[model samples]
Target: MPFTQAFINESFRFKTLLPLNLMRSSVENSSILGNFIPKNTRVLANIWAVHNDPKVWLNPQIFNPNRFLTDDGKEVIKIDALIPFSTGKEILKTIPLVKQFK
Candidate 1:
């Protein structure tokens, strides 16, 4: 069941439904990735870019559910970068709802 869930997760990450996150305004001046972000600046995050980032996932372009599996292959490892539907409170409750299990 865990591997199946991992596969579903990888599938979502492989072809993200919504690649762009909701636009957010900076409440205050902040620096991100060494760049200056002024207050009131509209900022949008790219979920696809993060999902495919080399720094975050090894061989990210390849469809590998094992990336979300534990070493023993008995449990699914939660990955913070697998956000196909952008980021929000709902994103925190991400869980595959498939009913079949072997």
Candidate 2:
């Protein structure tokens, strides 16, 4: 998919997918991997790569929002593999805004 207007418009149904997309970009862009690892280091920066890895997701390159949607398409919840914002991060900066429509 070209990821143009139609894809953007349809994204409303898969709100959580937005963060996943961002994380994928972040991981792909970073080069900290294979460079250095200081002793006693606890945090890592390859979260994005991990989320979209082929071993983790089916057809990761394809933008399938339905992957995150419930089988019945009723509700959406964050899956452990899709951690884009990281745990205990600032809520204000990572929270997704829900839009109410009439």
Candidate 3:
């Protein structure tokens, strides 16, 4: 399933609020603020680097939509891996309508 769908399913299954509360909790609990990301971190998030890491992805530089596609041809996107907002002090106020996966 797509990350958003999975999040929704899990949230529904657990009976939790959407978007804000979860995001807040994740930020609060993240190690990015401490060790993973440097202190005084002003570097623009290397989203490209994260998305294209050969160690994490099968084809680092290739634009393979199949990388995100599921066995059923629906796109199986991972949310945590593709956070457009990146980790920062600013919070995302809007929740996007994410594509669904089987």
Candidate 4:
């Protein structure tokens, strides 16, 4: 069962159905990872970039469902970089509904 969940997450991360999540905007001036941003700047989280980043993931391009499984292989590891639905209040609200449907 855990491996099943891991496989699903890995598939979602690798496939990246949307490629890019909904665009986001800065509510006020902000700085991110040494990058500065003015208020109301439109920003998009490149789903593909984050999912495929070598720094965040090992062999990101390779389809490896085992990556999400723990060494014991009994539990699925939660990967922060895997954000197929993006993240925020809206997504948090929708998650339960999605789970129910799924």
Per-model TM against the reference: 0.77, 0.42, 0.40, 0.81
Poorest 10 consecutive residues by lDDT, candidate 4: 93-102
RMSD of model 1, in Å? 9.4
Prediction-by-prediction clash tally: 0, 0, 0, 0
RMSD of each: 9.4, 12.9, 12.8, 8.3
Per-residue CA lDDT of candidate 1, range 8-75, in tens?
99999998887777887778887654567699998666777767778678998899999999999999
Q: Where is the poorest 10-residue window by lDDT in model 3? A: 93-102
Those runs of model 3 whose alpha carbons end farther than 4 Å from true positions after fitting are: 1-43, 89-102
lDDT of 3: 0.39
Q: Look at candidate 1 and tell me the lDDT of residue 5.
A: 98
C-alpha displacement of 57 in model 3, angstroms? Answer: 1.4
Q: 53-77, model 4: which lDDT tens digit per residue?
A: 7867799989999999999999999
* lDDT, candidate 4, at 9: 96
lDDT of 2 by residue, 11-68 (tens): 4333433333322122232224234434444433344454455665677667776665
Superposition TM-score, candidate 2 onto the true structure: 0.42
Candidate 4 Cα outliers beyond 4 Å, as residue runs: 89-102
Worst 10 residues of 2 by lDDT: 93-102
lDDT per residue as tens, model 3, 1-102: 464554443233233222222122333422432345334433343444444446555764544545554676455555343444344444222122111100
Better of 1 and 3 by lDDT: 1
In candidate 1, which residue ranges exceed 4 Å CA deviation?
Answer: 89-102
Stretches > 4 Å off in candidate 2: 1-39, 87-102
